[model samples]
Target: MRTAGGVAGAVLVLAGGLLWDIPGLEPAGERMLGIFLAAIILWASEAIPLVATSMGILLAEVLLISSDGLFDVADDVGAVPAADYLAALASPVVVLFIGGFMIAAGATKFDVGRVLSSAILRPLGGRPRPTLLGVMAVTATLGMFMSNTATTATMFAIMLPAITALEDARSRTAMALAIPVAASVGGMMTPVGTPPNAIAIGILADQGIRVTFLDWVLLSLPVAVLLILVAWAFLAWRYLDTSSPLALDADARLDTSRPAVTFYAIAGLAILGWLTEPLHGLSSSTVSLAAVVALLALRVMDGEDVKRLDWPVLWLVAGGIALGRGVGDTGLDSWLIGAVPWGGIPAALVLLAVAAISWGVSNFVSSTAAANLLVPMSIGISISVANSTAEVAVVMALACSLGMCLPVSTPPNAIAHATGLVPTRDMVRIGLLVGGLGVLLLSVAAPLLWSWLGLT
Candidate 1:
């Protein structure tokens, strides 16, 4: 099977090389087509993880893109060579992700998660509605500081006692599902909020586009407000407790450390670093690295804790950036968009298409994988549509980060659905409703944000 696959790849590469003679298609166009076909085979056969296929596409692109100029190497089809494939996966932005992951790992392992968690989840909830609101608020805060999974986990733990006190199991289950959805939506408020945002920003940085942390929060605020309100309404409409629980006033929380000075210190510094990066000329990567060092120096975290970070996810994000870059290099992204007539349509139509594409793709694939692919494609489309990368990428990031549309969409949603408070039908019904509204909100709100920020 390996031999056959390799032979097939070789043949496809040859066919791609010969594509210059076929009609008006250029070599890059043909190569991208071959890459697309290879990607399909990998996805359908599950022969390799979807991310690996994305990396493979990157590998092919790096080797084939002619830095020597297209016409310079016109006659020599094999002039691009194969060894450039290895370097295709390496990029400054990908390295930055690794460093960021390591820092997050060290901080989390040092029990500093507790430090971060308490700071973000302050102003605790007193009742079901309040608990839901508090969870949304905390989810948004923590998501800006950490990964979506980490933020959801912390918020879930923080709200557990208050929610369980409601006494009814159904309310408990609904609140759990609500937690991840809010976190996912809130995450769009910052680039570090999700991998897709980080990668998208990296891509745009290369294209002379920059959006600061404050810029992100300001831009995404409207959509966040809409999502939060919709989330509350959806939960209330479907499962709100009209009557107070028997133990509404009683606390369900377990004993935990109260807020720490270290937690406050770290929070302040992290925010300052992120906020001041634009003026101070410190990249977010440097700012985050500095925060990690502070945690270690202050004895807030230790060496062993850093090892707890998910190394695979780091690689996965790198693969995502590589894929986005490959699409850029191969001109595949350009070809795909040009083939589609993006420029002639209204910008709103383009955003709506991205939101819908994200929604449908995430239902069956890894949300991270979907984000990695769709975001760059969106950015590529933006060039034609008079849309900015930030405009398109932010909406896709929100949709990708959320993935609360089905049990298969994300792990937290799955856990909540499995608890039985949410039947499959219940999940589908609410999930579809929330997902649809969220998409529309992102599509409409992103451009408004750009205008409000004077980005246009």
Candidate 2:
């Protein structure tokens, strides 16, 4: 049945490609063949890992686009404001956590993972569930410096104690559920915290509109804080943990030889530069990469950690941004907006739909992929409705931050789940309730902010 479905889908794609005149096909229907092949590859991608899927996308582009049209396709597809386009490929700007990760690496340079684990375990020495909030706080704070995944992995090494300290299977299950979900929610605070926000921000900037770092912080932080509060409340009511809060003093003060303090200092300086980028004339990407370089110079981390970075996450980001650029460059985004004509749909309704789609897909897929796909579509829809790219882009950024509805929705939650803290059923219960509330907040908070900013 799957194979049959794949074949039918391939035929439809081929027919459509032939109708559209995509590059690289001779008059004898070669375009349709290539289109059919791409469609199959996209379908097959579902069965493979995502980085493989992305590499497939890159390979497909290489095969289907002619040498002559390759440059043209890129030029047409990649033309959103140059700066905005570049932001898609930039490192995350989580100021504190980047410093924290470096400090962590140094503190455990001889056996960093184990050393970091020992520290986290010692500090979070008591009750398991409460640490979920602690994790979120840490991730969100770190998210202010790096990407959500980075925050999750880094925090995971630190949270070893809390995960181990929790009660039996049921409690352990609950903790696992909360951690990754919290990390997902934590990314809401800054543009650099997640791909969706960065993508939307860049797209709008390309259209000659821009939001400053402070502006983004001002707009996003309130929503993040509120969501954090709400998520914690939901966890408490659901888990009903009867134990005292866990302890971690033995680990927190570990006497490691690594220059954790110095790493922190460099990270702090890097952030000061990022936040003041407009003044410094430095891009967020430049600042983050420079700080990463600084971390290496101090011998805080080795070459191995660099190789472990999630390339799929990076590629997913690059591909999505590339598509957004493509659409913007060809005026395809505008053209599609005209064709769909969201002008007839009320803004409230459109916003509601966008939230639903984003939240629903985030439950299982990587929120980055969902956000990359959804945000641009929402922007196109928004432009159709309001005829303003900035408004649509901003709302899309907010909507992307709403992927708190499931354990699989975000990285922190996944890390938490790995510890076997809570039941899957409980996670769904809490996530649905809290994530639903988050959706509601975005619905109300977004428009209110828009009106206040005079953007609506």
Candidate 3:
């Protein structure tokens, strides 16, 4: 029923916008609006696959507004080249994420998570509080490089045995809750840490603003660490019993196979390249491709590995890039900026409002989708207000990742809820606290920090 309603509503809106005239909206803008509204409905309701909606956006733009579009338009109306829409798939940001996915896949294949967990957890002395902290720390650290979902799964798989052995229900709940919380927070540490970050960076790159890997890390890592510690303190106080010891027996054996050794070398070099981009004069995307090639050439990863990677994510991001381009080319962005009375509002409040809206919408939809829908508008609004575009973009992106109030909010949250150890009410309570804290910090502290560091 929801899917039917969504599809019906999208069709109606598209037809109405295309056929009927809208005041102050150009013909090209009207066409773009139809596609944009339809995309919102489809993405929000998930009436179809998110990637499907994204692909539709690209195709719709080409057919409706591109220079070579099917329909005729007045000479005064501007149209972007079809190639611009199609080229979104291989955008630098998309390429960067592709590399990130490859590295994550290789790490999972080689059982790097297990080895790291075993080494990191053994030193915490197995006490409940310390064990929980260690688990969260490992999860967050991995999340900085891996997707939050993958990081959560890896940590849970390694720690489930120890968590299950705990007699106290609160202890079990705390341990389970910590993984998603840490994963979500830690995902903000780097541009590749989550899809929203990548989407934001991609959008900014389109506007010719470059956010390097190290620059993103410098901008967000402090806040990530601070949020993780704050969450840990709350969980420990509320659920953990420090008097009890947790028995964690992890598999610490490192894979010594030739392929494993080769992967280690490639992974290390890839990370080094990403961090030293300025010195090497190589874009992160190029370095990632090099690592991917090395892995394949050395047989550490094969075609099958490549096939199993997360292509849908890349497609979804590409769709967003295309959407942003359409919005810009059709003057839809300017129309949107003019539609709102933004001049009367303070820039700081506008930034906070965007962050709040991003957080709220993300609680119901995927973070990537929320970022896809909002980042473009945020960029336009930021520019109109003479505010820092990068600051607004990064805040909205991080805010999207901060939504963890329910199982459906994020894949990591769903994974934790699936364990059945965490009740819905408990999740809401802690999630709201952590998520609210994140928004506050992002809105208040982060801007000052960014300015001090000259990041904005």
lDDT of each: 0.63, 0.56, 0.88
What are the per-residue Cα lDDT tens digits for candidate 3 across 1-456?
Answer: 999999998998888768968787789889888988999999999998999999999999889888888877555254667898899999888888888888899999999999998898888789787778888889998898899999999999998888888888999999999999999988999878898898888888878899999889988888889888999999999999777788888657999999998889889999999999989899998988888888888899999999998899889989988888888777788888898888888877887788889999999999989988888886789877888999988999999999999999999999999999989998998888887888888888899999999999
Identify the runs in model 1 with alpha carbons over 4 angstroms from their true place: 1-23, 40-47, 62-125, 157-166, 246-264, 296-302
User: CA lDDT of 452 in candidate 3?
Assistant: 96
TM-score of candidate 3 against the unseen true structure: 0.98
User: Compared with the true structure, what per-residue lDDT tens digits does model 2 show for residues 400-440?
Assistant: 65655555666666655565565556767767776677666
Model 3 misplacement above 4 A:
73-78
Q: Residue 337 deviation, candidate 2, in Å? A: 2.5
Which run of 10 residues does model 2 get worst, by summed lDDT?
24-33
Q: After superposition, how far is residue 299 of candidate 2 from its true place, in Å?
A: 4.0
Query: Per-residue error at 354 for model 2, in Å?
Result: 1.8
Model 1 lDDT, full chain set = 0.63
Given candidate 2, what's the lDDT at residue 441?
67
Worst window of 10 by summed lDDT in candidate 1: 246-255
